[model samples]
Target: MLCALIGSACAGARDEGGTDEADGQGDEFGGSQECEPDPRGTEPEVALPSPHEQLYELELDTWGISNAGGDPVETRTRMNEALAWALDNGFEGVRIPAGTYRVGEKTSDIYTAGIELPGSMDLILDPGATLEMAPNDTWNYCVVAVRGLEDVRIAGGRIVGDRDEHSYGGADDEGHGVCVEGASKRVLIEDIELTKLTGDGVLIVGQSEAGSCEDITIRNSELHENRRQGVSIVGGIRVLIEGNEIHHIHGTAPQFGVDIESLSFTSKDIMIRDNSFHDNQAGDFVNTDGTNVWFQGNTLDQGDVTDQVDGPIVFWKRTDQTIRDNVVIMHSPTVNGLWGVIGYTNDDEPRANPVPNYIEDNVFEGGGIHLARNHGNAVIRANQIDGWMILGSRLSCLRLSDNAVNKAEGESYKFREVQGVASGNLLNGAPVALPMSDDAPFTNSPPHLW
Candidate 1:
């Protein structure tokens, strides 16, 4: 059932179930907002020490790239030549000057046949340069790939995909701007612009069981206007995505700012902090099945966009997530109604798992909590909500405490056939009894709009 939303998104990914910023754009868009420092009392363990300082700090033509004018054959030859040079005499770093290098050609392979990233080096492009993937009719193609490598960093410049010129004859929807695949570790991608992709702007997908990713960090980037997701995590661990602005992810299913869904392997210890997310088609964030994922201090806004399919956030019951200190502004709800966050991606039957989730210290303006059914053990505490609180129907061991919801005078907390402890909560300046009956606030008509 999870594959319905992500099956096509994971075209080259061997995981059958499929997968699963920039600075702030515009003035005062909060796209450049950073996270609260050391919430866990420590910095992330990112291994990005560039030790190859004395080796290869040269320019574009030094690596046999004389002319870069988006010619597929010539650019591919130059790229292969550069790659061969890097392979022969140890790659340290290379800089591409201000130019447009179009990669990929018709003679390349169908799946993932593009410019591959060399391990243990730095590929720094000039701020005015761009690496554009040449238009092809393939389902799977990566403009820049970091496959099964370590100690790599890609910074500066822009990497554009082939969404506009793709012929769509491959009959699949995976043409990423940059693909970080295989068992790669210690990779860092920062201060870059990734946009106009047929699939995700960037995809961190594991090809098989022996090729998952770890210790990955993507920060200070701008990813937008992708057909699928801004970023898709098919398989990864210890991934931190911070301080990016992601928006307007339309034209596909499950089009979140980030979709973390691992099928065969485990993807744990992920953090998405201090990002500005808005105008996404499906939602801002959705964890189909990720472990120990934290969404901290980000701004998720569903502004005047009325065609939102999913809400701002959707997480399955199997995830061990901690969502705290984020600001959710919801002007319009999705097909799942007005609750800004949901327990499932769709309005279907919920999955009942025993994982622990903490939803603490968040501010929801015109939005509310919707952790209905026996999803998990949720601790919903200390939030200022301006909308409904629909946590009902056999939710076990729930803790609803110290939350202030805007309700009518003499109104009570509406929970139907639920098992929970509700204390220190206020609805319309009154502390109505939540456990007074099976459906204490509303006995028959339990507040359900979807």
Candidate 2:
């Protein structure tokens, strides 16, 4: 992915070497296998490991968190106390040993679950420890809540949500495994296994006075088998999601591996790189309202497990994105595969965009790119596309150059509705005039992508 339309694009300072790969031995999503130092990105950006000093080993009997595992309300009360005990006692780090603690509480209309952390602390869960959210009827719940805090690190262990025992008769069902909300900054959630939620594996939402979380990193983690999304970034700045396997997102609409749809322009400088995305039901990713978003170096594979509904990647009318250096594999030309690798669209009428969306250096195994509508500028360069190169959309300017195109099917359409220039392209290894005029080019029609 290309590196947004706002302030400045921030990059993570890495150490060296690759992170530990998922063992992939038993289950689908694999384990919290303690990834090595520095996450592995296709572009090789490393995450600094959180330091641990003066770390206190918390005892379950002393903290009394596991004693009330059978009772939801009591567990929530004890869990909150256990998390705060260390911070209040002048400690910067605490470790929870092996135990299964069920937690949540309902008071009035608001329901709170999991352990909420304070600022400037490190919370480590032992290898066998599992913090499971209790069954509830509320529409919103979180297994771990990091709300409006700063300089927090949550690592190791597993955070499981209440998907199997959740009541589904209600309207809203947003039970996330982890929630990082408010204007929280300098947060790192790494090497954890979060799965089986009704909502998302992790939801990084901005609900504070600043309107966004800053400098957040979720890396070397496994987010799998979630109901809605693997990672939902409603608002975050300088966010990095790398070296993880986000898979098996199904049982709902817009079920993507990572969804970066912020309210207004709240999200910018977000990078989704070097991750393995496979068997995601709807698609791998979708950037609806993010600026300066880079979706690069990720491996997206829609195997025989499921049919993709929204293709591999889809973006709304944002011209400040870079989608590059990705290996997108489409199993077969299904409904969304005709125009598969990446798709762009807009619902309302034309609008002006200053920046240009760059789609470059991508290797599309059996897919291509598609632009539907709206007046935005785009640059499509140096891609190996085996499917449609349909660019009939209304745009401000389009630069199509140095791309190799080979058709999956025999038929190809003409492009009579473009407003840019195409040059140095190869159609089946032959120099073909781009933006092929009505009878010369290949283009997708209006709206309604099947």
Candidate number with greatest TM-score? 1
Specify the poorest-scoring 10-residue window by lDDT in model 1: 14-23
Tens digit of lDDT per residue, candidate 2, span 286-333?
877777788889998887645566677877665367888999888765
Model 2, residue 72: displacement in angstroms? 3.6
Which residue runs does candidate 1 get wrong by more than 4 Å? 1-3, 6-46, 49-51, 55-59, 62-68, 107-109, 209-211, 345-353, 408-412, 436-450
* TM-score, one value per model: 0.84, 0.82
Assess candidate 2 and give its TM-score to the true structure.
Answer: 0.82
**Could you give me the TM-score of model 1 versus the true structure?**
0.84
lDDT of 1 at 255: 79
- Cα RMSD (angstroms) for every candidate in the order listed: 10.0, 12.7
Alpha-carbon shift of residue 119 in model 1 (angstroms):
1.9
Tens digits of per-residue lDDT, candidate 1, 214-287, equal 88888999999888888888888888899999998877676789999887767778889999998898789988
Task: Using lDDT, give the best candidate's number.
Answer: 1
